[model samples]
Target chain A: MKARLRNFLVALLALAGHLALTSPAAAATADPLPSWREGPARQAIVKFVQTATDRASAGFVPPAERIATFDNDGTLWTEHPMYTQLAFALDRIRELAPQHPEWKTQQPFKAVLDNDLEALAAGGEKGLLELVMASHAGMSTAEFEALVSDWFKKARHPRFKKPYTELTFQPMLELLAYLRSNGFKTYIVSGGGIEFMRPMTEAVYGIPPEQVIGSSIKTRYEMQEGKPVLTRLPEINFIDDKTGKPIGINTFIGRRPVAAFGNSDGDREMLEWTGAGKGARLMMLVLHDDAEREYAYGPANGLPDTKFGTFSQSTMDEAKQKGWIVISMKNDWQRVFSFQPETMNPAKK
Target chain B: MKARLRNFLVALLALAGHLALTSPAAAATADPLPSWREGPARQAIVKFVQTATDRASAGFVPPAERIATFDNDGTLWTEHPMYTQLAFALDRIRELAPQHPEWKTQQPFKAVLDNDLEALAAGGEKGLLELVMASHAGMSTAEFEALVSDWFKKARHPRFKKPYTELTFQPMLELLAYLRSNGFKTYIVSGGGIEFMRPMTEAVYGIPPEQVIGSSIKTRYEMQEGKPVLTRLPEINFIDDKTGKPIGINTFIGRRPVAAFGNSDGDREMLEWTGAGKGARLMMLVLHDDAEREYAYGPANGLPDTKFGTFSQSTMDEAKQKGWIVISMKNDWQRVFSFQPETMNPAKK
Candidate 1:
C-alpha cells in the first residue's frame, strides 16, 4: 500500500511540474505586446486588435481584411543620425568617387564627397534624386541586391556603434509580431527605395519582399550576353512620399490598410487613408522625445529640426485633431533597440 | 463465447469498410495534378516540382523562395471573343452613354458604340488607353470594386453564355492548388489592370488582392463631402506586358519566380527571366488550339493571328530553343472550364 501511494505521489508531482513549465507560455501568448508598457498607446493598439479580431464583436474585421502598414524610417528604427538609405548612398558615393573624377567639380557630388551638410541640403529634392540615381542605378537587380546585402553586414550606426539592422526598435518589432499573431498582414510602406529595403526587410522586420511598397527607379529588362537581366535605369519611376504614399499603397496593395504607423508628415496621407476606412482602425505616430535613450525630434520636444524625417508642428496638430495616438518612445517602450551599445564592436565606428 | 465471436466479426467488418472509403482519398493526394492529363506537359511540371521540393535534390528550393507567377487573361481564362476588360469597358460606355453625349462623335467611342471592331483596332493602343481611363477611373476604389463585382454577376460571355468568373481553366486551377500545396506562393502577374482583376482573383483563382500585380492608374487620396476618398486619376502607371513583365515581376515580387505560366508573347520576357534562374525551373505557355472547347489563335496549328494575345512565330521559336513546355490545351486538358455551357443562362447571351 505504501509503494502504490509513493507511485501516485510521483505521478502527481510530474504533472504539477509540467503544468508549471507550460503556464508561462500560455500567459506569454495572452500578453502579445509585452515590450510595450501598459499605457493609452499600448491600450489603444490592444483594443483595436481585440475588436478587429473578435468574431462576436460588432467591430470585427475579417482575417483577410486585416492589412497593417508601417513606415520604416523613424517609426521602426533610428532614422535620426541620418536616414539609413541616405547614409548608404553617401558611403556608396565615396566608394565610387575614384571612378568619376568629375564628381570633384560637380556641386552635389562635390558636396557629398566633402561632407558639406549645408551644401547638400541646398541641393534639395533635385540634388537628392541625382545622388540616388548615381548610387542606386547602373547595375543588374541581382548585383544590386548582393551589394546592399554586403553593405548591411558591415555598416554600423554612427552613434549607436551597432549594425543598422540591430537598431530596429524592439517595441515596434513586438507590435508587428503581435498584429501578425492576430491574423493581420503587415507591410512596410516607406519613402525609402523599394530595392534597398527588400534585401533586409524579411530578416530585420519580418516583412516579405512582396509586402514592401516603396519608391523605385525605372528598371529595364534586356537580354545581355544571352542571359535575361533587369538593368536599373537612372530615371525617377515613383516617389512614395507625402500624397504619393496613398498612390503607392493603392497601386501596389489595392486595398486600404486598417492600421498605419509612422513618425513624420510624410506618413500623413497613409494614416488618413487607414483612418478613413469604416469600423475599428489604428493610426499611430511615434514621437521621439527621449534624447537620453534614442534621439528626440519633432516640434513637440523642442529638438532640432531634421531634414531626413521631419515632424513639423502642423503634423502634431493634425494627429491631435484626428485622434491619432502619439506614442512617446521614452515612456512607452521598456527597451529601445534589440541590442545594447557596449555589446557592439565600438571599433566599427 | 457466441457474443465474443460476434464482436470480433463486427470489428473486422468495420476495418474493411474504413479501408475501402480511404484508399481513393489517399490515391488522390498521391497524384497532386489530377486534372492535368498524363502527358509530357504534365510530366515536366511534376518533375520540376519534385526536384525543386526534394531536400536531397540538387534543384531543391526553400519554401520561402518557392515563388510561382501566372498570367491571367489567355492563360487562366478565355481571352478570345475580345479581352474581358475591353468588353467591360464597352458595356460601361453604353451604360454611361446618356451622360456622355459627346461619346457619340468621339472616334474610339463611336467605334465602340457602333460595335465596329475593325475601326477600334485601327485606333490602336492609344484608343484602348482612352477607353480604359474613361471606364475604370473617376470613381473610388470601393465603388470600382462594387461595379466590377456587379458586372461579373450579370455579364455573360457572347459564345459561352457564362459569367467570366466561371470561365477559368480547370487544369490551371488544379495546377495552382498543387503548387500551393507544395509550399509555393502563387501570384498573378498580368498585363490586365490591377484594380479590374483584384475583385475576382480571390474568388476565382484563390489569389488575394495583394498577390495580384498588374498595370495601374494613379489614384489620389482626398476628402469628398467630409469623407475620405481615393479618386482614380486618368493617367497610365506601370504596364505589366512584354518587356514590362520582367520589370513588374522584379518591382513587385523582388524574388525571381521558379515557375511562370502564360499563353502569349507578352509572357516571353517573364519566361525568359524564369528560365535564366539557376536550377530546376518550369516555364510553360498554354497553346490555345482547341477551337471547339476554347478559342485558338496563334502562329501554330494554322490558327489565325490575334491582336489581343499574340503567340507569334518568334515567341514559339524561342520557346522551342529554350526548351520551354508549350501546353496543348486540346491534348493535355481533360476539361477546359470549371463549368459546362448547358448549365449557364442561354437567354443572357
Candidate 2:
C-alpha cells in the first residue's frame, strides 16, 4: 500500500510538471486589468468588480444580475470638442453642401460649410440639435444606416485624419471586452441618434443595436414589396441624453444596471441611478484632463473646442460621496484612443 | 538551495494530507438542471455548450459576445390555457369582479366569471388581447407594476393552488444563472405585455425589465408632480408574440443573439434568426412531452384541461435539421417547477 501511494505521488508530480510546461509564462503572472493605471479610480473599479465576483465577498452579486452600462461618445470612446457623430455629420454637410445651395446660405449649415468651428459651437444644443435634425432626420432608417455605413468607411477625423471608428479609446474598449468576459452585459447608452449609432455600433463598440440606447426619431412599420419594413420618420421619438439617459434606460431596458460609466454631467442621473441601487453597484465618470491627448473641458468657462458636455464640481462631490470612480484621462489611462500614435499627432503645447 | 527545495516539498506533502483529511466523500451528483430529463434534447444541449465553451475545440466562441435570448411564457415557465399575466389578470378580475357589475355582462368577462375556460380559449388571440387590454391597460407604468406585484403576492395557480411565480422551473432558473456565469446575457423576448413582465421579472428570472422584450401597449411621458411619468395608454403598441417576437427582437435588441429558447411554434422565427445567423449560435426548444410529470402538449394532441398555442412537426424537423436542441421535460429534466413536491401533486400515471 505504501509502494502504491509512492507511485501515485510520482504520477501527480509528473502531471503537475506537464501542466506547468504547457501553460504560458504570462498566464501565471498576476496582471491587473491591462489598460488600467494604478490609482484610486483603477483601485475602486477593481475592488468593486472583485467584491462582486468573489463568492466569499459580502458584496458578491450573482453573475447573472451583473449588468454594466456605458455612455458611448465620451465614456467608451473619444468625445473631444464636439461628438464624433457631430464631426461625421459636419463632414456630410460639407460633402452635400454644394448640392443644396440653401445650406451655404443657412446659418448653421453656412457655418459648417465655411468650416467655422467657433460659430458652429456657438449654436449650442438647440442649434446643434437643429443641425442634426436637418441632416440626420427625414431619411428612412435603412437608407440612413447605409449612408452612415458608407460614410464611416470613408470619413476620417479632421484633426486625427484616421477612420472615425479607429478614434475609439483603446483602454475603454479593452475594459468593455474585459467586463463582458467577467460576466457583465455592456450596453451603450448615449445621446447620439439611435439610427446614426446602429450601423457601426456592433463593429466598434461590440454592442449591438438592441443594446444601444440613444436619441431616436419615431418610426413606422410599413409594407414595402410585400414585406414589413421600419421607416424612420421626421418626428422626435425619444431623446436619450442628459437626465434623459436614466429615464430612457428605465423606459427601454426596464432594469437599473449595476455598473454605469460616462464622461459628462449629462450622465449624472444614470450614474446616480446605478450607484443608488440596493445591491452592489459601481459608477465611473471619465474626466478628460489631458488636453494634448484629448480635449480638456468641463463646465467651467466652456471652451467651444471642447466636445463633451461637461463634468461639474457637483458631480465630482457626488462621485466622492457615493464611492463612484472618477477616471483622470491624464493619469488613469496608459493609452487613450485606439488611433493613438497612428492617427493623432499629440497637439504641441 | 537543495535543502530549501526539500523543505518546501515536505510542506506541500503535509498540506496535501491535510486537504485529504478534511475532504468529505463526494455526494451522489444531482442533475444540475434537475427540471430536465436524460434525452437527446438534454444531450444536444450539454454537448453544444461544452463544445462551444472549450477554447481548444473547433466550435469555440469568444466569450465577449455571448448573448442568449429566451421566449417567456411556455419557453421558460408555464403559459398554459392562458399566459401567466392573464392568470394574474384573472385573479385581479375575480378580486375586482365584485366591484365592477359591468364585467358580468361582458362576453369574455362573462366567460371568465362563469369559469368557462373553454369558452374563453375559444375567443383566441383577439379575445385574449381584449381581455389583457381591459385588465392591464390605462394605468401609469408604476401603478401597473404595483398592481402586478400585489397580484403576484396573493394570486395562485388554479390547478397547482400555488403562487404563479413559484411555478417557474428550478432547472431553467439555474440554467439562466449558469449561462450568465459562463458569459451569456439572458434576455426574455416574450409575447406578454412588457409592463406586466417587468414588475416580477427581476425577482423571478434574475432578468431586469430592460432585458425583457414583450408585447406592449402605447405609453406617453407626462409630467406628474414635477416628474416625468410614463402613462400607459389603452391602445396597442408593439405585439411581441408569433412573428411579432422576431420583429420585436430586431427592433429592440438590434443584435442577433448567440443563443435562443422557446417551447412552441410562436418562437420559431426567433430560433431561426439565432441559429441561421453567421458564426456560432445555439437554439433550443422545450418540448412538453411528460404527462405524468407535467402537462404534455403540442398541436396534435395537447392537454384538454389547459390550452395555449402549439407547434407543428415541420418546426421540429426544421429545428433538427438546423441543429437546434429540443429539450424534453420528461426526459431531460430531473425536476420540473421549483414548487414541485411541495406545491404540485405529481399526476398519477
Candidate 3:
C-alpha cells in the first residue's frame, strides 16, 4: 500500500506540473489586457484592479462591492456609421416599408428608404423617437427579442462589412474579462434600448441581460387566449443617457461602481457618479483619434465633428482635470476589432 | 523520498476523511430543510430541485436558467395586523410629527398618532398613499438608506416582541439556501418599496439589493454641493403587484422564473407566469392555516379575511386547477421563525 501511494504521488506531481503548464489562468496573468497597448489608461485599470483585489491593501474592495460600469455604443462597439440600434431601426423601417406605403412620403422613413442621412438628422429626436416606437415596440417581448436576434444574425456593419457583434472593441472586451476575473461585476450601462441589447449582450459582451442596464419602453403583462405575455408599449419609459445613466445604474444595480468607462458626453454623469464612490477608482474615456483606422469624429482633439457620440472639447478638459484616463485609439489600442488583422485593417496590412 | 511521499499520502487521506465527516455539505445533505416537516409540500420542493439540477434528468434546467422568485411580505415574514412597511410609515408620521405641525390635524396622520385603527382604515387608499409619499420621498438615496438601516436597528414586531428581521420564516430561509445550493438564483419580487427592502434584504434574506425587485417612487439625479445625489421624488414609478409582478420580472430579470413562491392573490400573476414556462416548474402558495402558531388569514381554507395578503377562495380554486402546491403553515412548516422554540412556541411546548 505504501509503495503504491508513493508511485501515485509521483504521478500526481507530474500531472500537476502538466496542468500548470497548460492553465489559461497562468497565461492570462502575464497580460490580461494584451489588446490594450502599454499606456497610462491600461496601467490605470490594472493598478486599480490590483489595489482593489489585494487583501493587505488599504484600497481593497470586497468582491461583492467591486462593481464596474461600461457604456455600450462608442465605448464598447463602433457607433461611427451610426449606432447599431439606429442601423437596425433603419433596416426594420425598410423591411416594413411595403406594408406602410405612407412611409415612402414621410420625412424620416423616406430619408431611411432613400439612404438620405442628412434628412434623417434634420428630422432630429422626434423622428428618432417615431422610428424607435414603430420598430421596437407593439409586440410581445419574446417576439421583439426574436426580431432583434434575427436582425443581429443578418445585419452587417456598412463600413466593416461584418456583423455588428464583430465590431466590438477587443481591448474593452479583455478589460471586461479582466475585471470579472478580479471579482468585479461588469455591467453595460447604455443609452441603447434594453430589449434590443438583452438579446445579444450575453453572447457578444459576456455580460448577462440582468447586468445590462439601458433605456427601456414600458411593458404590460396580459393574458391572451389563456397564455401570458409581456407586451412592449410604444411609449418611452426611461432614457439611459447623460444623467439617466447614473439613475439607471442606481435603479438596476443598487450599488456604486468603483470603475466606469465611456467615450462621449452622454457618459459624463455616469463617470462622475462612479468617481464619487470611495476607495480605489478607475474611470476612462476612449478618444477616437485614430481616424485612419477607425472613423474619428470626437470633435475633441481637433477631430471632425459628427452628430453621433459627441466627445466635446469641454468633456476632454473635464477628463484631464478630474484625473479620468483618456484612451487614445491611435496610441492605447493595439487592435480595435477581433476580425481586424492583428495590428491593422487588411488594407493597411 | 518514497517513504516521505507514502507518509504524506496516508496523512492526506486521513485529513480528507476527517474533513468529509465534518463538512457542512455532508451534514446539509442529511436534511437541507429541517424547518420543513416531511409533507407533500416539502417533498415537492426537494423533488423539483433534484429533477431540475440532475444533468441526466429530462427536466434538467441549466444553472443560468434556474431562476426562483419569492414574494416578500406574508410569504417570508409575518404580515398580520399591518404590513411591516405600513407600521414603519406610521412610526415615521409620529417621529416627524413635531416638525410637521399640520400632521396633528391631518386625518391619516391624526389617525396614526392617535392609534385609531378604525379611522386609519376609513381613510383608505388615499390616506395610505399620503403616508407612503410623505414618509418615503424627498430624501437623498444615501440618506434614505441610512434612515431605513437606523429604523431596522430599533424596530420590533408588535406581536413577536422581537426585531422584525427575527420574524423571518426559518423554513423559507432554509428553502432559499437549499435552492441556492442546487444552483438557483433566488430573487424577491415584492409589492413593497424597493428602497425600503434594499437596505436589509442582503442581511435578512441573503438576497442582494439588485435581486430585490419591488415597487419604487421616482428619483431625480442631481449635483448637491458638488456631489452627486439621487433624491427620492413623491411620484409612483411602479407598483409591483398583480399583473405588474410579471412585467417587473420580465423587465428586470429578462427571464421567466422556473419556480415561484407567494401567499396572496397579488402574487397570482407571478405564479401563473412562472408556471407557464416550458421546463420543470414549481408554483406554491403559503397557506396560513395555523392561527394558534401564526395569525391565520388566508380566507382560502375558510380562514378569517384580512386587508393585507388576502389569499382568497377563488385563488385557492385556481391553484388547485393549475396544480399548484398550497403549503399548510400548520402542517408543512415544522418551525416558523428561528426564535420560535424548536418545534413549537413556549406556550404550546
Candidate 1 fraction of reference contacts recovered:
0.61
Put the candidates in TM-score order, highest first. 3, 1, 2
Please, what are the lDDT tens digits per residue for candidate 2 over residues B150-225? 8889887777788878878776897888688777778999887788888888889998777898887776655567
Which has the better DockQ: candidate 1, or candidate 2?
1
DockQ of 2: 0.19
Question: How well is each residue in A88-141 modelled by candidate 3, as lDDT tens digits?
Answer: 999999999999999989888999999999999999999999999999888999
What value of lDDT does candidate 2 attain over all alpha carbons?
0.74
- Local accuracy of candidate 3 as per-residue lDDT tens digits, B281-337: 999999988776787785787867877999999999999999899998888888887
Which lDDT tens digits does candidate 1 get at residues B1-349?
2445445544544544455455564335466665677899999998999999999999999998999999999999989888999999999988988899999999799998899989999999999998998999999888998999899999999998999888899889999999999999999999999999999999899999888999888877788886778888898878999898889988888999999999898999999999998888999999988777787787855777887688988889999999999999878877778675422322222
The sequence of per-residue lDDT tens digits that candidate 2 reaches over residues A172-206 is 88778878877887888888887788888888988
Clashing pairs in 1: none
What is candidate 3's CA lDDT for residue A219? 88
Is model 3 an incorrect, acceptable, medium or high docking prediction?
acceptable
Q: TM for chain B in all models?
A: 0.89, 0.83, 0.92
Misplaced by over 4 Å in model 1 are: A1-30, A341-349, B1-30, B341-349
Could you give the DockQ of candidate 1?
Answer: 0.31
